[model samples]
Target: MNLVDQGAFRWHTLWLERANRSNYRKDGQILNKQAFVSLLTPPGRGAVATVVVGGQDCVACVAERFDAACGRRLDELVIDRIFFGRWRSREGPGEELVVCRRSDWVEIHGHGGRAAPASIIQDLVEDGCREMAWPDLLWQTSADPFAAEACIALTQARTQRTAAILMDQVRGALREQWEKVIRALESGDIPTASASMEELTQQSCIGLHLIQPYRVVLCGPPNVGKSTLINALLGYQRSIVYDQPGTTRDVLTTHTALEGWPIELSDTAGLRDQASGVEAEGVERSRQQREKADLVLLIYDASQSSPEVILTEGSGQQHLTIYNKMDQRSSGLDGEGIFTNALTGDGVGDLVKAIVETLVPLPPRAGQAVPFTHRQVKALKASQVQLFSDQPQTAAAILRAAARVGPVVSS
Candidate 1:
C-alpha cells in the first residue's frame, strides 16, 4: 500500500537538535585542513555571523588582515579571548569585528544582515584559504554521515518541531535505529529487520514534512465564506472578504502553525459552474489546489436553505465538512459537521485542533527515530521490500550505506 501519497512521512521532531556539536575531523582530508575558510554559521542575515578560519597557517592568514584595538599582535593574543578589532580590506574602510582564537581555528564574528561576512570570506579565500560550504566542511568532522546530515538539515528546519527531530538523529538516535536493523539481519532474523524497517518507512509521512509543511487547502462553492474561514484560522485579514462571490480570484496561501506543527493554509477561489473569464480560471485553480492538498476543508453556508445539497462534494479527496456562518443558520445542523461562525471566530479553536489531529494523530515523542528525508524513506521501504524478497541481506547493506552516505542511500 502507498501509505503516504502526497509527501507526508507521519513523524514528529524532538531529535533534530541532537546533531549541532562541532567535531571538525574527517578521514584522508586532514592535510586539506591545513588552510581553509568557511562560514561556520548558517547563511543569511542574523544578529551576528561567524566565519571560521582553520588550518596550519590560519592564525597568520587572519592576522594579516585583522588589527587588534588593544595593540596586541594576532599571534600574541590570548586564545579564546574576545578581542575587538578592525578587519582591513583594500576595497574600503573596514568594519569593527570580534575575533576569538580557538585551539585550532579562529572565529571571526562580524555584523550580520549585511554583505560584510561574505566580503571577508572572499578576502580570506584570496589569501590562499580554501573555501568550503558549511555542510561539506562539517562532513569532514565526523565519519557518521547521518549526524552530519542532521546538522545540515537543522539549518533548513522551519519550525522547532522539525529541528528537534533532526537533533535527535544527530545525538545518535537516527543511527541507533538503523543499527538495530543491521543487528537483526546479521542474526538471520528477517522478521525483526523487516518490521523495524517498515515502521521507519511508515514514519515518512511525518518525517518528510518536518522540513516541508503539509499543505491544507480551503475550498467549497462560491460565497460560502471560505475567505472568512481562512481569516478566522489565521487570526488576521489575510484573505479579502466580501459579500460578492469570487472576491478571491486566485489561490492565496499563508504559512501557519496548528498545535506547533507547521502547516500551509490556502484560501482558494470558489468552485462554481457559472464562473467565467478570470473567475473561471481561478475556479479551475481551486480544483487543482484541492487535488494537491494534504487536507481539504469543504465549507458550507449554514444560512443557506439547501446546505445539504452539496453534501456529496470533494470526490476522491480527504476532507472535513464544516458549517460556516452558524449564527445565521435557521435550522439545527443535526451534528453533521463542525459548526463555526467565521466572522466572529466561534468554533474555530475546535476546527484548528481537529485539523492538526487529522494530519498527525500521534506525534512522535522525544528520542523516537524517524526518517527525515524522502531518500531515507525510499531506502527504508526498498530495504524492507528486499528483506522479504530474494535480496534478503541487502536490507542491512542499504541501512549501512544510508548512514555512511548523506541524505539518500543507493538501494
Candidate 2:
C-alpha cells in the first residue's frame, strides 16, 4: 500500500486539520486548550520521560493530581516556571514528577519505563485529558510538511550529529530553499530554481539514510573470525564463535550506533566451495547478503592462503577487505585489506570508521536542504521534471504543493 494510506501518514493529515482548528481558545490563547496529553519521548527504559499536557484545563487537570514540594496550588504557580512535586493517583503516593507551566500548556517530567509513563498517562486520562501519540502531536504542531518531517525524523535520530542536522530542517533549512525556489520560479528565474532543486536532490541521498541506518554485512569463509569480528564491532558477543567450520548457518543481524550514525551489522555464514547440505545453503545466503548489503566486510584469516578468489567473488559490491588473526603468524600475502586481531580488538576501530566512511563519504552540512522522506523525494522529482517542461507555471505549482503540510482547510 502507498504511504498515504498507512495509519501513521493518515493520522499525520487528519490530526493536522484537527489541531489547526482547535489551536486557539476563546481567550485568544494560541495553544491546543482541549485537555490532551502526549508523550514527548520514546517508550522504553530511559533516564526520564516527558509528557506534554495542553489546553484550557491543562494546568488544572495536572494540579488535581500533582502536589508540589513548595505547597503551591496549580493556579498559584507562575507561568513558564518549573515545580518539583509528587503525583497522587489512587494507587498510592505517585511517582516523583517535575511539572512546568507554559500558558495553557503544562509539561510533566517523570521516571522513564513502561510503567511510569503508562501510570502517568492513565492519571491524565482520568483527569479528562485525552492521550495522543508523539507523532500525531508533532504533525499538529508543525507549520508545514518540511517541519513535520523534520519533527518526525528528530524523534528517530540516533546520534547527536543527526539530531543537529534534522533540527536545522525544523528551523527552516528545507523550507527556506523551497520558498526560494518558489520565488525564483514566480520571477521567471528558472535557472535559480533548477539549481536549488538539483542541490536538494543530491543531499537527499545521504539525508534519507540519516534516520534509517545503513546495512553492513560481514562475510567470509568459516573459522576466519567473522563472528568474532562482529562481536568486537558490536562490543558484545552477539554472534556464536565456534572453532569448527560452518558454525553459523544463517544470517545474524544486530543494530548499533557507530560514531552517532545508526548501522545494522549483519554476520553471514562463511563462504567456501563444495560444502554439503546446510553449509552450502549458508554459503549461498552469504553471497545473497553481500549483494544487498550497503557495505560488505570481506574478512579473511591472515595465517591462511590468499583471499584473492573470495575477493574476486564479491568484487562488484562495495566492500572493505579485512585480514583477521593479525596476532598469529602472518601469511605475508596481502594486496589491500585492513589487518585486525579480533581476540585483542586491534584495528577494529579502523574497520568501523572505514565502514561509516564507505557508506556516507561526506556528511550533509548543518541546515542544508535535504529531502529525507520518499514523499519529499517524489515531489522533488516531479518538480525537476516540470522544470524541464515548457510550462513554468506547472513547475511553480508543484513546488508550492510540495511545501504544503496537509490538505487545505476552509474556514
> Which candidate has the highest lDDT of all?
2
What number of backbone clashes does candidate 2 have, counting pairs of residues 3 or more apart or in separate chains?
2
Pairs clashing within candidate 2: 33-55, 33-56
Model 2 Cα shift for residue 322 (angstroms) = 4.0
State how far residue 215 of model 2 sits from its true place (Å): 0.7
lDDT of each: 0.76, 0.78
TM-score of each: 0.85, 0.73
Per-residue lDDT for 1-411 in model 2, tens only? Answer: 222123233344433444445563233444454678887656566677777787667778988999999999877998878899999998888988899887547778889768898888998898788888877676555556677777677656777777778778877898998899889988899888888888888888778887888889998878999999999999999999999999999999999988888888899988888687998888888878778887888888888756535754645768898999987745567557798999999999988888888887877876687778877787777777777875567777777876765542211
List model 1 lDDT by residue over 83-152, tens digit each: 9999989776599999988666788989875498899999998889988776666665566766666766
Q: Name the top TM-score candidate.
A: 1
lDDT score for candidate 2 against the true structure: 0.78
Worst 10 residues of 1 by lDDT: 5-14
